[model samples]
Target: MTFSAFLWMTFGIFGTLAIFSFLYKDNPFYKFAEHLVVGVSAGYFVIILWHNGLTPNLFQRLADGDWYFLFLNSSKPWYLIPAILGAMMWTRFSAQYAWLSRWPMAMYIGIATGIAVPLEMANRINKQLFAMMEPIDFANFFGTQGFDLLDPTSGLSQLIVFVGAMCALIYFYFSKAHEGVFGRVATVGIYTLMIGFGASFGYTVMARISLFINRIQAIEAWRATGFDESNPEYHGGFPAVFWVILLGVVAYAIVEIYQHRNRPPQSEEPSA
Candidate 1:
């Protein structure tokens, strides 16, 4: 295959192996592989900034004598604000002017928190709220059985799930005590939440198994043939990146399990 294909093939093989190395234990090899993934991700983000911000808006403008774009917008030249803030971050390196750096840092954090709150709510509320309103059908995942939830078509499942979601949401409401309808509902919600979580955990395990199978496919197909992201020709045509993610998660899981297993057992001494 082509060099690019060869590169992906190499990544799929070793990356998969490096990830699986953690199965034995949380070794340096797995840590190296995991860190490599993170480093690559951070590097990729830098590349994106360079391509989107530097290449066009910064460097191109400087080259073309469009200083207005650098300092600010054509109308306002506000771009200078970000540049100034960026420069201010470096000030923290010194002892004296470190206080000057906090203005930008505070603004950055304040703006991020401002943006994130609304997005978090929309993600949790908008999607899940509707899900709460809708009927529950386990057969949706099975496809062929269609929407027939059960013989009785019990709304208890939906009620339980909805109550659980709502009650769990209420648990986060620190303003007041969970009383009245919320108190009763939230109690039910806790049980429903537990059941939902248990089912989800099972699903997650199955997904990991699927991922392992996919990684095997990627390695075998690409080893002889090639990895084609655009129009990959493989046994199952699975992307190598999926395997990387799966491996990373698995590695993290094993580490977590090992940590739990190795922790000193708690004493059950009688309380005074």
Candidate 2:
């Protein structure tokens, strides 16, 4: 492997192991990895926001006056309103004029809510209502085409979803006392919610396991085939840096254990 690729792989391996060290205990290595990740992410986000967001949307529009070519002759001064509001948000940093920041904050919230309401209604509410309203014919439920009742894409599944949704909504209804039939339906809704939550948790665990497996595979590959000059498959040699980090952590742990064992015990004063 080239020097650059080898260097990057070394860093990646060290970073991965350092993060995994947290499983043992909270140590400097884990803290270093955590801080590095947070710092890198924050820096990268700032760069992306400036280059892809502000540079194109704010600066470019202001400089070129390209307001969708709607106003060819007139300058696009309307864009300045948002820019001013954004600047006003920084007033919160000042001790004397912190209240001025509330105006921009309120405006931002109002604008965001105004934009999100219709989108949420169309994409979430209306579409979900349409999906739940699918016809539940008993004939179709037992037909040759409906072999799998549990299949999510099947029409029968819609009936199951509609029932679950209705039950869940009933569980949230606090207008009247949940007694008799309503209480039973609400109990069914609780079961449905628990099942949903369990499935979600399982899916999340699987996703994390998949990521861990991928990282382990990469580490194994690196160890099996050191960067060989002749063979592309074995590009880099065993990482000495990883060994150094491992040894350093081991030494630190040993020292901590020794110190803990040998430290003087505290003496209590006589009771008052």
Candidate 3:
């Protein structure tokens, strides 16, 4: 293996093991891995935002204007408003001018909320209402079978969805007391809600399991390159790096254990 590739693999193996070490207990290795990832991601995203966001949208547009004119000659002079607001956010670092930062923050939130509310209403409320209003195809409900509730597009499935939605809505209606028929419908609503939640939780757990499997696969891939010197992919440095890290960790653990065992115990004062 090339030296560069070997170095990358070594770092990968160390990082993977370091993160996994958290399962045993919190340690310097895990902290190092976590901080390294956070620091790298922060720096990476800063550069990405500068290049993809500010450089093109703001800087490039004002590039043609003279500095003396404050970029007023630029075609999109209005962009300066947002640029100034962004700059104003830095006032948060100043003790006296910290209040200035709130203006930009408020503006950001106000604009964001104004844009978000309508979109959310359209997506979550309007679309769902439309979906429930759709006519069920009872003629082809079974789709060549006696029952096909599993098919989302089937009439039976759509009918169940409509009924469950109504029941769930009724459960949230606090005006009428839940008793008799209303209580039974509300109970059905509880079942529907639990089923939805369980399905979502199951999907999330499966996703996490898939990620763990991927990590194991990566480790296996690295190990598949046999340790034999005769193998083309084999590198002496790979095994050397692994052993060095492993021994270092083991030695540190031994030192800690020895110190803990040999150290004098502290005496407590008599209770008042």
Candidate 4:
């Protein structure tokens, strides 16, 4: 492999191993990886926002100097408002004028909430209401003439969903005390909620597992580039670097264990 590609691959391998090393215990490797990720992500997003957001939408629109875009004579003078507000956010660094930052923050929240509320109502509330209101097709209950229990669009699935939603809503009714038939329905509602939560949790776990698998695949791919002198991807120096890093990590772990074993224990202080 090219030297640049090898260097990047080595970094990626080290980062993957460093993250997995957390299973052993919280150590310097994990901390370094974590901090490196956080630092790089922060800087990357800042550059992205500046270039993709501010540069195009604000700076470019107020081009041709136009009194440095401060005299309200630019083609899109309205862009100056957001730019000034963005600049005002920097006032947070100064104790004397820190309160000035609140104006921009409050305006941003107000505008965001105004935009989000209607979209959320339409997507989450209205769409769900419409779905529940639709008639269940019993003819296609078994999924187009076959016994497909997993088909969410089936009549049986729709009925169960309707009943579960109603029962779940009833369970939240504090005006009436739960007893007899009411209590039983509420219990069913709780079970349905548990099932939903469990399914969601399982899906999240599977996503994490998929991510782990991808990382493993990357490591495997890196290792597949064997040290064959005749091969185009051969790199004799990388294997040595990899071994050095591995040995250094092993040595660090051994030292940490030794220190913990020989360290003196602290005595508890007497109560006043």
Candidate 5:
């Protein structure tokens, strides 16, 4: 068909194969794809910087000779502020001016750390606590309203979940010793937290598996000109695409094994 359609198909086929490269335990093909992704991302960032930061703001502001607007816009751009800060940042290149670099670095660090602590603590504690303590209706669980374990209103699973969440939070309190009453109880909470974390991890892994299955489905849906079984396009079940994936992976694994077999010997150097 058209070149654009062919290009799309080509990329799709190759991307699918690239993901399967994981089975080979990493190789040049996987590395090539990885570098391609990084290169494309860097190119995108350069284009964005040119349009948003450099072109409209710096260049245009300099062209218009507007000092206030120059901080944002420019045409024949002086770009003094960023240029100065950028120059200050490069002061690290000189032994004498290296300490000057610390001012900007400290400012960045102070602002970042200041904002992060409160937000991180609130997200970790308050949100999790309220979520764990939400309302659960019990009438649906046991058929009879009296003794239903599954219904959140019945307070069985919810109690366990709540205890687990609270205990887990307490496990992080380092100011007091865990050997005391609260600390002993907090240890049990640690178990609950581990269970919760494990469940979340399992869910995330399943989501990745679902994405992998979706890619396979996409490849299966691609149609071409193959009316008869004897045609070259028939390719048994899948197309030549499957073999490329299967062999690419096999080749990668073989290379990995060979590399490992040829690894250099470890040294037994003394530590200070």
Candidate 6:
């Protein structure tokens, strides 16, 4: 294999094994992997923000005025206002002048909220209400073709959705006391919510499992091919790095067992 590919593969295998070692016990390997991930992610974000965000969006725009159609220009000196506001955020690091940072933060929050609220209302709330307001067509229920209750996207499914949503909303209506029929409907709502949560959890677990399987498949492919683009079917079996890590873990476990066996026990102290 090429030197660069081999080096990358080694690092990948070692990082994966180190992370998985946490299942055995909290150890230096797990800590190292965790810290490495955090550090790398933070560093990468900083680099991306500098190169993609700060440079092109702010500094370059200020330096070189943007002219559109040779008649309209937008990159005026006023562009420095946002840059100044962004710089004001760093004032939070100062002990005495930390309050100065709040101006920029407040501006950011206000602008973001102003932009997001209308979009959220239109996309989420309005759309959900419209979906729940589906027409109850009796003709479709008793048409020439018999109704299929098992069809998930049928009128029956829509009715169930509407009922579930209304019940859940009623359960959250704290103004009215949940007694008699209200209590029963609220109980059904709670069960519906629990089923929804369980399904969501199962989906999340399956997604994670799929990701894990994909990574394993990639590793197995690399092991079989030896990461050598020159030789498509090298048939190297497992990488040497994987074997080294496996042996190291086994050795560490053996040493830990030996240490636990030979170590002296603590004597009990007298009760006060």
Whole-model Cα lDDT per candidate? 0.71, 0.80, 0.87, 0.87, 0.70, 0.78
Off by over 4 Å in 3: 73-76, 144-146, 225-232, 266-272
User: Of the candidates numbered 2 and 4, which has the greater TM-score value?
Assistant: 4
Residue 250, candidate 3: alpha-carbon lDDT = 95
How far residue 67's Cα lies from its native spot in candidate 5, in Å, is 11
Tens digits of per-residue lDDT for model 2, 191-258: 88988999999999999999899999988766655544455555433455557657887899899999
User: Mind sharing the TM-score for model 3?
Assistant: 0.86
Which runs of model 1 end up more than 4 angstroms from their true locations? 3-8, 26-35, 61-76, 113-147, 150-158, 161-190, 223-272
Itemize residue pairs with steric clashes in candidate 4.
1-233
On lDDT, the stronger of 3 and 6 is 3
Q: Per-residue lDDT of 191-248 in model 1, one digit per residue for the tens? A: 7678779999999999999999999887766654544444444434344545665687
Prediction RMSDs, each to the true structure: 11.4, 4.5, 2.7, 2.7, 7.6, 5.0
Residue-wise lDDT of candidate 5 within 103-212, one digit each (tens)?
Answer: 77887789899999999889997887677867653544343466666555455666667777678878888888888789788989878877778999999999999988
Clash pairs detected, candidate 6: none
As for TM-score, the candidate ahead, 1 or 4, is 4
| Model 6 agreement with the true structure over 55-141: per-residue lDDT tens digits | 887677666554453212545567678878988999999999899899999999999999999999999999989989988555555
Clashes of each: 7, 7, 0, 1, 12, 0
Give the winner by lDDT: 1 or 3.
Answer: 3
By TM-score, is 1 or 5 better?
5
Backbone clash pairs in model 5 (N, Cα, C under 3 Å; residues 3+ apart or in different chains), count: 12
lDDT of 4 by residue, 171-244 (tens): 89879999999999998889889989999999999999999999989987777664446667887786876787
